[model samples]
Target: MKRILVIAIPLLLLTGCMHLNDPRPKHYKAPVTTVANKVCVIVQPEADEQIVTIRINEIGNDNNTLEKYGLAVIASAERCVTDFGYAFTAGKAYNFMVILESPEKKKRGVQPSARIYGASFSLWRLNGKLQATPLY
Candidate 1:
């Protein structure tokens, strides 16, 4: 439809113009802090040269809507493990998401690629270690 194309074309063009040097997060919604306790989260890219974003959500019980708990941007490949400093309540469910982006190709002066990849996982803490079971 015309309405769909009007919005989609400009979005595609804008993303296609994104450069590889723009590795920082444009905005963040959650106020998250970190601690060096007996907790850790590991996220690795399936391919090299990608931007990574992490989102933590709480699975609903009485309130069935998942609430966003934390958001983080991991730019470039340095370290993959981070402690979100959130205390995981026993017997509760949480969702962990890793979003990867490569708005442009690895080389300069080439047409922008504008690709996004992601993986979602169910989180659990067993025996003082964190476990992430992939959902997708």
Candidate 2:
């Protein structure tokens, strides 16, 4: 009985460790492409400004050629915000597509993992308008 108990305990410990190493599911989609040219917009606040870092992941399965589609800096905004002004070029329309990625929880030491939760993207316009084509 004593020998059997020892072997069972080790087996249980090994099984527990094996389950801990299981890979997490990849739940993210790539960003969509836009016909309009992309321009980086940096909005500075007047006073007590807050800066944000926005990431625009490429939209496609080609991992080797991932490019940043749209990037902008907004002040005091909770989520990512983009606006297109006259600088986008008069008469020529533009579109903006984004893939918002949710922050993932990473494992740290023996404690449970921590995750910030992120989102991914779609398409919009550089002029703050949603259109199918840049020419429109």
Candidate 3:
């Protein structure tokens, strides 16, 4: 009886350890570009119900290429605000895609162009369905 118990304990411990190292979930793909002429900026107010603001300096145009672009800062109470901004729609699903454009190659000035390196998207439950989209 003692021998059997010892072997079973070790086997159970090994099985538990194996389950702890489960594989991670697959990576999510971000949008490359978005349609021009339409730029969406979503804002989620803080707990205090403070007013959120976004400032877009200039949406650049490169060689007639249509790219989703914007420049702005986010302010929120929960400190969960993103660089571009947050998407907040009461009872409606929202998606945000932010593409950081690289600075112009040939331009010498005091301030360099703001280059967007990557983009991100968020999904959440709003109203009665799941709506997810990229914001740029």
Better of 1 and 2 by TM-score: 1
Q: Model 3 Cα displacement at 61 (Å)? A: 26
Q: lDDT of model 2 at residue 121?
A: 34
TM-score of 2: 0.24
Highest lDDT: which candidate? 1
Superposed Cα deviation of residue 4, candidate 2 (Å): 19
lDDT of 1 by residue, 1-136 (tens): 9999999999999998887666553321221112332323343443433444444455674343222333334444345434354445544555544444443443553333223333334555666655655544
Candidate 1: list runs displaced more than 4 Å: 1-39, 46-52, 61-72, 75-83, 106-136
Residue 62 local lDDT, model 3? 25
Candidate 3 lDDT trough over 10 residues, lowest sum: 50-59
Show where candidate 2 strays beyond 4 Å: 1-56, 61-110, 126-136
Query: Model 2 lDDT vs. the true structure?
Result: 0.35
- Better lDDT candidate (2, 3): 2
Give the Cα error of residue 41 in candidate 3, in Å: 13
Clashing pairs in 3: 42-86, 42-87, 96-134, 96-135, 97-134, 97-135, 97-136, 100-116, 101-115, 101-116
The lDDT values for all models are: 0.44, 0.35, 0.34
CA shift at 69, candidate 2, in angstroms? 19
Considering TM-score, which of the candidate structures 2 and 3 is the better prediction for this target? 2
How much is 57 displaced in model 3, in angstroms? 18
